[model samples]
Target: MKFYKKITEKSKSNSLVVLVSEDTDSINFSNDSVNLLFSESLSNEDLSSLGKITVLHTPDSLYKNFNFLRIICIGVGSLEEIDSNKIRRAAGSFGRYFLDSKLSNLSFFVDSIKSKDTDLITESFFEGFFLGNYIFDKYKSKKSEKKDVFFEVVSSEISNIQDIVNKSYEKSEAEKFARDLVNEPANVLTPTELSNIANNKTDKSISCKILSKEECAKLGMNAFLGVSQGSIEEPKLIHLSYKPLKNENSYWYIGKAITFDSGGLSLKPSGSMFSMKGDMGGSAAVIAAINAIANLKLKVNIDVLCLATENMPSGSAQRPSDVVRAMNGTYIEVENTDAEGRLTLADAITYAKGFDPKFIIDIATLTGAASIGLGKGNISAFSNNKDFMDKVKLAGDITGDFVWQLPLDSTSKKQNNSTVADIKNTGGRLAGTITAAHFINHFVEEVPWVHLDIAANSMTSSNDGWHNRGATGIPTRLLIELAYIFEK
Candidate 1:
C-alpha cells in the first residue's frame, strides 16, 4: 500500500473515508460531492454505534466531480473518550470494509478530529489500517486477487505526519513478518528453518549465531535438549545480538521456540494439535522485535535467544519420569512432557544470565491454563521485579498488546517441588501459569526477569480490531516499546 499525507481536496482516489464522532447527531463533510451523498444516507441510516461503518455510493453524475465511487464514514465514539487505541480500532474496521468491498484506492480525512494531537491520531490510524489489511493466503491454491491500495491521510496540519507514517509502517511491517513466521506450517517452518531465517537477517548491527545440538550438549543444556530428542530434526539454539554505537545497560529477550509441539511422549489429542505450528509464537515475536529495533536504530544493547526445537513423541522421547539437568546446574523432573515449553525456557534463561543483563524477559506459548485464566486477549505475566514489570505493563498499554499480571508468591513456588530433582516441569493442574513462571524463576535467580505466557494471545480464531483471524503476533510491539523505554 502507498500512503500519502495530503489535503482532502487533492485526493484522487475512488473512495473517501471520514471519521465521525458517535456523540455527533448530524453529518458534516468538507467535500460538497461527499456531503450530498452522505447527507442522503444520514437521513436513512443510524450510525450511533461506535466503529460502525456506513457506506454511501455516489451518484453516477457526482462520481466525476468528487473523484470517488463511494464515501465511507466510520464512527469514533465521543471525542472525550477517544484515544489512540480507539482510533486504531476504528481505522481497522474501515480497512476491513475496504478489503471486503475490494476498494483499491481510498483517502482518510481526519480533519474532523480536532481534540487530539494530529500527529498521534494520524499515526494510530495508519498503524491500524495497515495492520488490518494483512492477509495470510500463502497456501491457497486459488488465491483471491487483491489490488495495491493507494492510501491517503488528509489533514490541514501536516507536521510530523510523514515521519509518524514511516515509523508506523516499519513497525507494522515487522509485525507482519512475525505473523508470517507463526502462520507457516510445521512441515515448512522447522527448528532448523527458523534458525536459518534468523541467520539470514542482513542487518549490519545485528549478529546471528546458531548452536547445534552438540554445542548445546557441550554447554550442558540438557533440559532444552531433552525436549528435542523426540524429533527427527536437529534442534537449534538461536542467538541474535544487537549492539549500538552508544551502549548502556543491556537486556536479554528469550523466546520458547517450539516449532511444532506434539506433547512429546505425553502426546496431545488430534484436535488440540492442529495449531501446534504456532508453538514458536514467542520466538517469532522476539525475532520480529529485534528486526524492528535494528531497523529503527534504537541505541540500546539487546540480545535475543530462541531455544528452537520440536517436542514430538517417538521411541527416543523423554519419558514421564525422566530427569534432565539444565545449563544452570538445576535438575528438573519431567512429570508431564506436555509442559515442555518451560523445560526449553529454563535452559535458555540460564544462558541469558551469562550476559549479565540488567533484566531478562522470556516469552512463551507456555500454558493452556493461562488462556483459561485470562482468555485470548490478554497475556499472563509474572515478574520477579515489580518496577520492571510495571514498565512492561505500561509498554503493553501503549502498544495495545495488553498483559495482566499473575501472582508469583511463595505459595505458587511450592507447586513445583520435586522429591528427586530440584523442581518438577509441571506443577499439576492448578495455577498452571503461575507454577510455570515460578519454575523459570529458578533459572533467573537474582537477575530481574519477566515471564509472559502468550499461549492465548498467540493465535485467535476471530478478528480483533487490528488483528486478523490468524497469528496475532501478540507481544512483538510490546517488546519493541519496552526496549525503547529501557533504553531511555
Candidate 2:
C-alpha cells in the first residue's frame, strides 16, 4: 500500500470511504468525496461505542453507493478519550472493511481528527491500517484479496514524521516475517529450517552466524540442546549482529526459538498443543526487530540471538529429573519439560552475555501464566531496571502495544529455588509468569535487562488491531520505537 499527503479537497475520482463519527445528515462537503458518519444517534452510549459503526447508521453501504473511489470519515470523540489506540483501531476497521468489500484503492482524511494533530492520527491510523492487511496464509489454499491503501494528510508537518511511519511499516513487515515463521506448521519450520530462514532473510548489512548442535555441545549449551535431542531435526544456536556506521551503543536481544513444543516426555494434552506452532514467536520477534532496525539503518549496534530447538516426545527427549548445563556454565534441572521455552532462552541469554552489551531484552512465549496475568492484548514484562522499564511503558503508550510490568523481587525468585541445579526450570504453580521472569533473570548477569513474556500478545485468536486472524505482531512497533529513544 502507498501512503501520501494530499491537501484536503474534493476528489475527481470515484471512491468508497467510511466516516467514523460524521453526521451524514449535516455533511457539507463541496467535493466528490462521500462522507459516511457514525453519528451520536448511531453510536452506542458506552465506551465500546468508540469503534462501533452499524449498517443502519450509514443508511447505504458506503462501498455500495459511492461510485467515487474513496470513502472518508472523521472519528468524533473527546481528545482525552480519542487516544492513539483508538486511532489505530479505527484504521484497522477502515482497512478490514475495504478488503472485505474488495475496494482496490482508498484514501482517508486525517485532517478530520477533531482534537489531536492530523499527523498523529494519520500516522497511527496507517500503522493500524497497514497491519490489518497482515496475514500468515503462506500455506493456505484460498487467500483473501490484497488491498492497496493511501493515507492523505493535509499538512507538511507530516513529512517530518513520515520517516517514523515508514520505519514503523518496515518494522511491521519484519514482524510479519516472524509471524509467518511462527504460524508455519511444525513440519516445515523445524529448528534447522528456522535457522535457514534466519540466515537467508537477515539484512545484508548485518553479520549472521549459526552454531550447530555439535558446536553448542562443545561450548556446553546442554540446557538448550537437551530439549532438541528428541527431534530428528538438528538444533541450532542462531546469532545475528548489526554494527551501525558508528559504534556508539550496543543492545542484545535474545529469543526462545522452540519449533514445536509437545512438552517433551512430560507431554501436553492434545488440546493444549493446538497453537504450539507459535512456540517460536519470541525468536521471530527478536529477529524481526533486528532486521527492521538494520534496514532502517539506525545508528545503534545490536545483537540478535536465538536458541532454536524443538521439544518433542521421543526415546531421546530430555525428561524429568534431568540436569543440563547452559552456555554460561550454569546447571538447570528439567523438572518439567513443558517449561522448555526458558531453557532455550537461558542458553541464548547466556551466550549473549559474552558480548558485554549495555542491556539485554529477552522475549519468549515462556509461560502460560503470562497470558493468565496480562490477558491476550497486553505483554507481561519484568525488569530490574526502572529507567528502562519506564521507557518501555512510555513506548507502549505511544504505539498502543500495551505492556504491564510484573514483579521479579525476592518473593518471585524464591519460587524458582532448586535443590539439584542452580534453579528449577518451572517456578512453582503460582505467579508462574513472575517466577519465569526470575528464572530468566538468573542468566542475564545483572545487565540492565528486561524480559518480555509474549505468550498472550504475540498472536491473537481473533482479528483486532491491524492483525487479520493469526499473528498480532504485537510490540514490534514498540520495540523499534523504544530503540530510537535509547539510541538518542
Candidate 3:
C-alpha cells in the first residue's frame, strides 16, 4: 500500500471513500458531481447508521464526469464518539471494500470530519488500512493476487500530515513484520532463524547479540536450556540493545521465544497443538517494537532479551519432577513440561536484572488460564510495582491494546512452593496466571517487573477491530508507546 497526502478535488482514482456520521442527516460533498450523486442516493436510501457502508456505482454515461469508478460512504457513529479508533475501523472497512471490489486506487476524503486532532485521525486511518490489508498466504499454491493500493488521505487544515503519515506507516509496517514472523511455520522459523532475524536488523543505534548453547550453559542458564533439550535445533539467547546518543534511564523487555512448543514430555493434545507456531508472538512483538523505536529515534535506552527455543518431545526432553537451575541460581522444579514458557522466562528475567533497569517487562504466551480469564481481547498483566503497572495501563489505553492488572500477592506465590527446589514450575490449576507470574518474580529479585501473559490476545480466529484474523501483534504498539512515555 502507498500513502499520499492532500488529495484534491481534481484527484483521479478508481474509488473514493467518505466518512458519514450518524448525526449527519444529509450528505454533503465539496465536489459538485459527488454532491449530486450522494444527494440522489440519500433520497433513495438511508446511509446514516453507524458502520453502514453505501456504495455508489457510476453510470456508464457519467464515467467521464466523475473521476472515480465508485464512491463508498462509511458511517462513523456520532460526532461526539469520533476518535482515532473509529477512524481506524473506518479505514479498515475501506481496505476490505477495496479488496472485495478489486479496486487498486482509493481517495479517502478526511476534510469533512470535525475532530480536535486531525493528525491523530489521519495516522490512525493509515495504520488500520495497512494492517487490515495484511494476508498470510505464503504457502498457498494459487494465492489471490492483489493490486498495489494507492491510498490518499485528504485533509485541508491538518499541519504536518506527511510527518504523521510517515510515523503511522513505520509503526504499521513494524507490526506487519511481527505478524509475518508469527505466521511463519515452525519448520521455517527455528530458534536460530529467529536470532538471525534480530541480527539482521541494521539500525545504527541498535546492536544485537546471540548467545549459543555452550555460552548459556557456561552462564548457568540451565532452566532455559532444559526447555531446548528435546529439540534438535540449538537454542539461542538473543539480546538486543538500543541506546540513544543522550539517554536518562534504561528499561528491559524480555519475551519468551518458543518458536514451536510440542509440550516436551508432557505433550499437548492434537487439538491444542495447531497454533503452536505462534508461541513466539511475544518475541516477535519485542523485536518489532525495538525496530520501530529505533526508526522513530526515541531517546530512551532499551534492552531486549528473547529466549529463543523449541519445546519438543524426545529422548533427551526434560521430564516431570526435573529440577533445573536458572542464571540467578534458583532451582525450578518442573511438575509439567507444558509449563515451559515460564521456565525460559525465569532465566531471561534473571539475566535482565543484570542490566539494573528502571523497570523490566516480560511478555509471553505463558498460560491458558490467562485466556480463560480475559478471553481474546484484554491482556492479563501482573506487575511487582503499582506505579510501573499504571504506566503500562496508560500506554495500553493510548495504543488500543487494553490491559487488565491481575493480583500477584503472596497467596499466589506460595502455590509455587516445592519440597526440594526453591519453587515449582507449575502451581496447580487455580490462579495459574498469577502463579506463573510469581514463579518469574522469584528470579526478578528486587527489580520492578511486569509480566504479560498474552496467550489469548496473540492470535484471533476472525478479523475484528484493527486486527486481522491471525497474529494480532498484541501490545507491540503498547510497548513502543510506553517507551515514549517513560522517556518523558
Give the alpha-carbon lDDT of every model: 0.84, 0.73, 0.83
**TM-scores for all predictions:** 0.93, 0.87, 0.94
lDDT of 1 by residue, 1-488 (tens): 34454433556587777777755545445466666666666666765356798877875575555556776778788888888888888777766766677687877766666665666677777778888888899999977677876777665566666677777887788888889999999999999999999989648889998999999999999999999999999999999998885545578888889999999889999999999999999999999999899998888888999999999999999999999988888889999999999999988987887777889999999999988899976889998899999999998987788889989889878989999998999888999899989998888888998999999999989887998899988788889889889878
Cα miss at 34, model 1 (Å)?
Answer: 3.8
Tens-digit per-residue lDDT, 216-242, candidate 3: 999899999999999999999999999
lDDT of 1: 0.84
Model 1 poorest ten-residue lDDT run: 1-10
lDDT of 2 by residue, 264-331 (tens): 99999999898998888888887788888888888778888888888998998898989988888788
Q: lDDT (0-100) at residue 50 of candidate 3? A: 56
Backbone clashes in model 3: 0
Off by over 4 Å in 1: 1-9, 23-33, 36-44, 63-65, 116-120
Best by lDDT: 1
Best-fitting candidate, scored by TM-score? 3
Clashes of each: 0, 12, 0
